[model samples]
Target: MSEFKRAITAEDITRLQVYSDPQFTPDGDAYTYVSTAINDKNEYESHLFYKKLNGSDATPWTFGNVKNSNAQFSPDGKKVVFQSTRSGLPQLWVLNTDGGEAKQLTFFKNGAVSPAWSKDGKYIIFNASLDHDDDVESQKEQSKEERQKQNEEKKKQPLVINRLKYKSDAKGFHDNKRNQLILFDVENEKFTQLTSADTDHGYQDISPDGNFVLFTANLNDDADYELINDLFTLNLKTKDITKLTDGKGGYHSASFSPSGDKIACLGHEFAYKGATLSELYVFDIATGERTCLSEKWDMQLGDLMIGDTRLGQSTTGPVWSKEEDRLFFIATDFGATGLYQVTLNSDLEVLYKDDNHVFGFSYDPHSDSFILGISTPTNPCNFYQLRKTSELVRLTNANAKYLEEVHVEEPETLTITADDDQEIQGWLLRPYGFEEGKKYPFVLEIHGGPHAMYGQTFFHELQLLAAKGYVVLYTNPRGSHGYGQSFVDACRSDYGGGDYTDLMSAVDYVLENYSFIDENRLGVTGGSYGGFMTNWIISHTNRFKAAVTQRSISNWLSFYGVSDIGFFFTKWEHGLNLLDDPAKLWDFSPLKYAENVETPLLILHGEQDFRCPVEQGEQLFITLKHMRKQVEFVRFPGSNHELSRSGKPEMRIERLNHICRWFEEYL
Candidate 1:
C-alpha cells in the first residue's frame, strides 16, 4: 500500500483541477500557460502563470481567481489579453504582462474566446458570440423577456429554425448567431464590428504588414465542402473583406510570410469518409496560386518517425524564421517525433529527430533562435531552446516539484502479431514492486477517442494502477490515430469485431511473453468507447475476474437517442438506426448479452455527462440486476463525462480509488 500513495485519495479527488492551453511571449524569453488551482476560497480558480525562459520565479497574473486562459501577449510584450468567466459567461480581460490588476475588456453576455493580439498591440481582435441569448437554457429567461417585448409590438411568430444540428462539444445548442470577429481599441476601450454576415470568422491572424487581417470562415456556404474553413482577408484601413482562397476547396493553418508577400496555408479539406489527412499548401498572395507541399512527403505519423506508434504525420505549429524562406515546424507520423526546416525553394531538411515528442515550438525572429515545450515516455514536461550548441534548458519543472512524493513508471513498447498476421503495438506499465519471476494481477486499459491517440505522455491513473501491482497494457488499436487514415477508419463499423480482436490478441501476447502477469487474475476497464468495450468484455465472456466501466454505453439504441452526437454517430459508426439498423447495433451492444455476464461488475458515471449520459450506466446496472448479475453503481455528483481528464480533482481521485477498490475486492 506504500506505493499505492499514487492512487488518488478522496481529498485529492475532491480538489482535482486539470491545466492546459500554453501560450508564449513574442520574445520567446517568457511564457505563460493556464493552471487551475484551489485558492483559500476553495473555489475552482484558474490563473495565468508567467515564467521567464531563463528560469526565474514564475509570477501569477490576473485577479479575482476565476478560470482564465488563451493568453496572448501584446506585440511589444507589454499587456496580455485573455478570456475569463469572472463576470458570469466567459468574457475578455486584459492585463499587463509584467504584473498588474486585470482590466475588463469585453462585457458581452454571451461569451468570448481565443483572444489574438493586433499587429501594433494597440487593439485586440477576438471571436465572440454576437447574439445567441435564445438558444440555451442558461439564456432562456433573457430570451423570454425579449420575446415578450416583441409580442407587445406585433403578432407572435412561431419559432421555426434550422441551424447547426449540434453547436460544439463545449457549447451545446443548434441555434445561435454566428461567432463574429470584433476588434477592440485598448486605448479607448471601444469596439469596431468586423464582419456582418451570419458566419463564423475564426483564426483572426493580423498580417505582417498590419494593413489587413487573414482568417478562415465558412460564411454563407455548405458545411460539407467549405468546412476546410475558407481563407478571408479583411483590410484594416479600407474595411474591404476579400476572399483569399477561392472556389470549392477549403484551407487552414494560414499565416503570412515575414514580408507579407506569400502565404503558408494548408489548402486541403477533410472528408468524413471514416479517416482524413490534411496537406500543406503555399499560396502566393499576389498571384493567388497554390502549390501542394505534401507531395513526396509521407505526411502521416509513424511514416517518417522511429519512436513508436507515436509515428506518422507532420501536424505541428508553424513558425517562420527571421529568414522568410526558412520555415520551422515539428513533424510526426506512426513512429517518432521529428523537427524539420523547410525552404520554399525546393529543399526540406530534418533538424532533429528523437523518441521524445516536440510540440508548441516558437521562434523569435529578432534572436534568430527558438523555444518550445516537449516531453517523452519517462519525462515530465519542460521548455527548451535551440541555439549555437543545441542547448536545452528547462523552463518550468511544474510536475517534479509538486509530484516529488509520488512515483511514476516509464512505459515499455512492444509489438505483437495477431492471428491474421496484423501487427499491433502498445505500451506496458509494470507494477511498482517488481519481482522478475513472480506473477502479478493484470489490467488492460483502453483509450476512448477511438480517434485520439494515447501518446508517450504521463497519465496519473495508469501510474496508480501500476503502483497497485497491476500490470497495465494499452495499445493503439486499428482505429487509433498516429497511424494512417485507413488504419484509424478500420474500427468505424467494426467496433466489437476487429477492434476487440486486436485487444484480445494483445492480452494474449502479454500473457504469453510476460512471466509476471497472472493468467487467472485478469481484468479490463475503459471509458467512453473504451467503457463500451469494458461492458462488452464482461458480457461476452467471464475472462475477467471483475470489471469497472466509466461513462459507458450499454445499448446502442439508447445511445443513438440520447447522446449529443447520437443521430450522426449511430449511422456513421454502426451503419444503421434504431429501426433501420436495429439488428447490427444490438448485436454489438453489451446489453443484449447481459445474462451472460457472470463476473462481478462495477459501474461508475458522472451526473453532468451529456456525451454518454449517466443513463447508460444506470441502464447497464438495472439490466444486470434484473438478470441477477453481481453489479454495483457509483455516481459522481456534479461531474461530467471527462472525469478522467478534467473533472473535479477530488472526484478524479475518488474515481481512481473506486476502480482500485473494486478490483482489489473482486480480482
Candidate 2:
C-alpha cells in the first residue's frame, strides 16, 4: 500500500463539528458563537464560546450540562443575551460578557427565537409564536369536524392527513400566525408587546439609535402571499409603523448602519434569463432614496433560502460592520460560496476566495482581528483568528481526539467530459490506505437537490465509505448549482437524459484514470433527486452490485398529490403543470423501469417525511418486491427528509451506522 502500513480502518464517524451564529462583541475585542458540543452518550449541549480577537483561548460562558446557543452581546459589552432549550423550550438567558451565572430572561411556553438587542441594550426584541396553536386535542377536534364536513359535502376526493405538520424537512412549516414583536425588559424582568397585529411581521432589525425596528410583512393582506416582502419600520417608543421599500419582489434582511442614517439589505427586484436574482439595497431612511446596489455598484444579489434554494439562488446573509460603512455578505456565482465586502458608497470587493463554504466570521474592531470559521473537503470545521497575516491560527480542535485513531482520506476534484462533450466536475475520495495498483470497489455518491453542489467539505458518511476500502465518487451534475445559472437550468426538461449521461461519463472517467479503482465491482447511491437517479441507473444497467435510495422520489405520479411541496415543485422543476395534463411526469418516474432492474436495492426513508413523503420509498420497494427483485426498506422513526442533515443525535448516529452496515454488507 504505497510503502505505508495498511490501516484496517482509515476513518470512523467519531466527531462532527459545527459553528453557528458567529458575531463580534460590542467592543470588537472578543467574539462569540453558538457551539454544539457532542458527547459519548450521543447527546448534544450547545454553549457559547468567547475569545478575544488576539487572546489565546476561547472561554465557555455556559454550564450545568444544558443546551445553549445564539448569544448576542449587549451594547456596552458587559453581558451577552443568548437562547437555550435547557428549559425545554427555547428561551432567552443573559450572562456577563466576562462569564458569570446566567439568569433567565423570558419564561415562554410557545418558544422564542432570533433574539436581537436594541441599540441601547435595555430592551430585547424577538418574534414569538404567541397565539399560533396546534394543540393535539385541538387538532383532533378540528380534524373530526373537518372529516364530518368532508363526508357531508361528499368531496371529489377523500380528505386525509399524513402528519400534523407534513412536508417538514430541516425546518418545519412554522405556524407562527400573527408572529408579533415581543419586547423584554432587562431590569424589571417584565415583557411587553411592541407590535400587535393580525398580519405576520417578521425579520426584526433594530435601528442604530434603538428607536425603530426594520422588518418585512404582508401588511395589506395581499392575496398573492408570494409577492412583495415590503420593508416596514416600527417606532419602538410611539408604536408607529412606517413602510419603506415599494419595489416588487421580496425585500428582507434589513440592518441599520452604525450612523443610524442609512440601512442595507438584500432586495429581489431583477430577473436574469427569466430567473430572479436579488440585489443589495441600502435605503436612506432619512432622504427616502432607495438605492439598488447591484445595479449601481455591481454587487452580487442572489436569491437565498428559497423553498428550492439548493437548485436556485443563495443570495442572503448580509450584516454591517461596526463602522456601518462596509457591508459584508455571502455571494454565489455558480455553486460555491464566497464572502464579499461592499462599501456603502457603491464599491464591491472580494474579501476571501475559496470554493464552497464560508462561515463563522466575527469582526472585532477593538482587536482589529477577524475570528473566521472555515472548512474544506478534507478538513473538519475549525475556528481560526485572522490578523495581519493571511494565514489563520486555529482555536478549537473539536475532532483532534477522535481523529488520532483514524486515517481520514482527503478528497480530490477532477473534470470529466460527458458524451455531449460538456465538461462536468467531479470529486473522488480514494479508499483510505489506498494502494497504487490494487483495485478496490467504489461507490458513486450523489448529493440531494440534484441542484446542490458537493463542494469542498468533509462529509461523515462519504468519508465512512472511503474508510471501509471503497472508493467514493460524487459529482455536481448538469442541474447542480455552483457552476452558474445555465448549468443548473440545463436539467429542467431533460431529467433522466443528459443528467444520466453526466453520471455515466463520471464513472467512465474514474475507470479510465484510477488504476486502483475496480470498475467491475461498482455501486451507486444518492438521496432525494440522487435517490431518484439511483433508481434510474440500476434500471438502465445492472452495473452496480447494490444501490440505496434515501427519501427518494421513485414515482412522480404518486409524488404529485401526496407531497406538501410536490404540487408546486412538480410544475416548477419538470414543467408538470397541475392545470394541464402532464404525461411527462410519469415518463420520468423510476418505477416505470422497475421491471428491468437486476441490482439489489436498499430503500431508506424517514417516517415523517412529507417533502418526498415516505410512500415514495414504499412504492418503489413494493414494486421491486413484486417483480421479485432483491430489495429491502429501512424506515427511521420521528425522522424527516433532512434526517441525514439535522435530525436528532441518536437517530443521526443510527443512520450513519445503518449506511455503513449496508455498504459493508454489499461491497
Candidate 3:
C-alpha cells in the first residue's frame, strides 16, 4: 500500500494546534502547557495539558471551549493558577494538579490577568482594570448583561478626548478604567486592592519572601505624552512604594534575586529612541543602585521573531538563577532567538541556539532542565525538555497526526549581498509537488514590524502559498531584529532608501541563483510595515504582476493623525513629525506614487484598525481606481490590525482564501 498525504490548505489553519506558555512544576516532576485550536464553531479553544517528566504521555488538565492561559505553578507545586475567560471575561482560576474541580478566584468587573503566586502560595498577585471612582463592591454587584447594557449606553454618548494617547489597537478606544493591582488571599477568599493610581500598572514579580511586589508604571504627570515604563517595588506590609528606576528609561521583565537583595531587569534609556537594544540591568535593593549588565552585548534581548501562529505570551526574562549569581534570558541574534546566561560579574554564554523559534520556556533550577516551546519551519510548536548535556526530549506530539496528513515544505536559507555590500538573510520555499525544469509562479512575502524579523518559523500563509504551486520568498530587511543593533536600526529615517534596495537586491539574487522561479509571474504581499513595503514596491517597479497590501500605510501625513501610535511613531521612524516636513512625509507616502503603479493590487484593511487606520487603504484604493488601474478593496468588519495573526477564526480563514483567490486570479 502507498502512503497518502495532501498539500496544506488555507483551511488547515483551523485544524492546526498552537502550543505555548510552557510551565514546569517546582520539583520538575511534571510540566503544563496551553494548546489552542479553532473548533467547529469557528472560535478558539485553549486548554491546559499536563505531562509528567518521567516520559509519560500528556493529558488534558482543563477542558471545554474557554481560553485558559498564563499557567503558573505554585511554589509548593500543588496548585496551578491561570487566567481564563470562563466567566464571560478573563479572570483568575485555580486548579489542583492532583485532579479536582477548578475554582474561580477573581470576580473583578474588568477581569484580572497575569497572576503570580506568592512564595508561600497563600496569595496571588494580579492586575485588574477599574475606574478610579468605581468601588470593587459595586462592580461585583453588576452582572455581565447589566455591564454590557451600561457599556452600550456609554457608547451612545459622545467621547470626550483630552489625552494624546486615547486609543489603542488592542483595547480600542480608552475608557475611564485603569489597570490596578489586586492581592488575592487564597485561604481567606479575600480580594485586596493594592495600587489605586489612575494609570495602568504592570505586575512583574513577587519577592521570594513575599514582602514586596515588583511592578512597572508611569505615574508622572506627563505620562500621557511620554513613553516610559519605570520600575517600582511595593512593600506588601506597609503598602509603601519605592521607585527603582530614574524615570529616564523604559524598564520591564523584572525579577527578584533568590536572596531578594538584588533585582534583574531588561530595559533601555532610549539612547536611540525605539531602536535601542534592551540591556540587562541589576538593581541593589538596599542602596537603590542600578548597574547595566548587558551594555556591551550588541544583541537585542527577548523573542523578536514574528510569526502568525503564536497565540499566547512567553517568558522573555531576566530569570534569576537558584544561586543568584547568574540570570537566564532569551535574546534575538542572527535570525534566531536563543537562550543566554549572564552572570552578575558580566560573564555571558549561550545556553541554546538553533535554527528554530523558542517561543516560550520554563526553567527548573532543581533539575537544571528547561521546558521549551519550540517551532520550526515544518512544525507549529511542541514542548521539549533540554538539559545541559542532553539533547531535546520531546514531551508532546500535538501536531504529529496533522503533520502525517499534510505536506509541509522546509525553506532553503539564502544570503544575498545588497548593492552596498550589506548581507541580507532570507529563505525560499519551493512549491509543493515541485519538479525540476518546471517553472512556477513566485510570491514574495514581507513581514510587518520593519522592526520585526521573519526567521525559521512555521507560517501558515506562506505554506498555503507554496501548497498552491508558488515558490515563496521571505527576508529580513535591514530594519528587522535579530541582526545587531546597527543593522536593525539602519532602516530608520531612510525607509525607502536602503531597505528598498535590500529587498530588491534579494529578488535579484534569488532570480539569478534559482532556476525554478518564474520571473514573469511574480507576486508581492505584506501586512503593516510589510504592507507599506508592498505598496512601495508596486509603485516603484512594475516587476510584480500582483500585489496585496493589508492594514498598510499609504500616506504618512494622514497616518500621523489617525493611527494610535501615529503621533509619535511618525517622529520616531521617519525622523520628523508631520509639522516638521509635510512634503517629506508626502514624498515617502506610497499614495503619492499611485499613478506609477501598473501592478494589479488588492487592498485589505480591518475596519476597526486603529494602528494603520482603514482610511489608508481607502485612499490608496480610491486613487488607484480613479486612475482606472486594476485594484480591489477588502474591508474586514469589527476586525483590528491583528486580523492576520489573532483575528476572528472564520475571518482569518476568509482573509486567507481572499489572498489565495487574488493570486490565483492574477498570478
Q: Write the per-residue lDDT of candidate 2 for residues 1-667, one digit (tens) a residue.
A: 3124333222233255556556777776667766665556666666777777565577877765567876777888888777787766677788876556888776655567667788787888877656644221121112345546755785566545433233345454434345667877777766777666655678658877878888887666542224456889988778888988764666777878878888888766534322344578888877999887666432234321111101101123566776777887776544345567788676887776565455446566665566666555655556677664556677667556555545667678788899988889887888876777798999998877765567665567777778778899988888776665567678876788899999999999989988888777888888888888998999899888878888899888877777876655676677765445556777888899999999888899999888888999999999999989899999999998877766666676776666667767877
Per-residue lDDT for 262-317 in model 3, tens only? 99999999877778889999999988888898978889999888888999787868
Collision count of model 3: 0
Model 1 per-residue lDDT tens digits across residues 1-667: 3344343233442233333445557876766766665556545677777877676887878657577877888888888888887776677888886566788777664577778876777778888776633222132222446646765754555545464344333444444577777777878877777776666678647887678888888765566222446788889899998887664556666788878887776545445333455556677888988776665564442222212112111225455666778777666555455567778763777766666667556566766655655666555455566663566656666555435555567788878786677787788998886778898999998888666566566566776778788999988777776766677778888888788888899999999988889989998988898899999888777899978898999999988878877766777677776789688888989999898998889999998787898899999999999878899999999887777766665676688889999989987
Query: After superposition, which runs of candidate 3 have C-alpha atoms over 4 Å from their true positions?
Result: 1-4, 137-142
Which structure is stronger by TM-score: 1 or 2? 2
Between candidates 2 and 3, name the one with more favorable lDDT.
Answer: 3
- As for candidate 3, its clashing pairs are none
Cα lDDT computed for each candidate against the true fold: 0.71, 0.70, 0.90
Question: lDDT of candidate 3 vs native?
Answer: 0.90
TM-score of each: 0.85, 0.86, 0.98
lDDT measured at residue 496 in model 2 versus the true structure, 0 to 100: 87
TM match of model 2 to true structure: 0.86
Candidate 2's C-alpha runs over 4 A off are: 1-14, 132-167, 170-178, 198-200, 220-228, 245-248, 267-278, 287-289, 295-316, 333-336, 344-346, 388-391
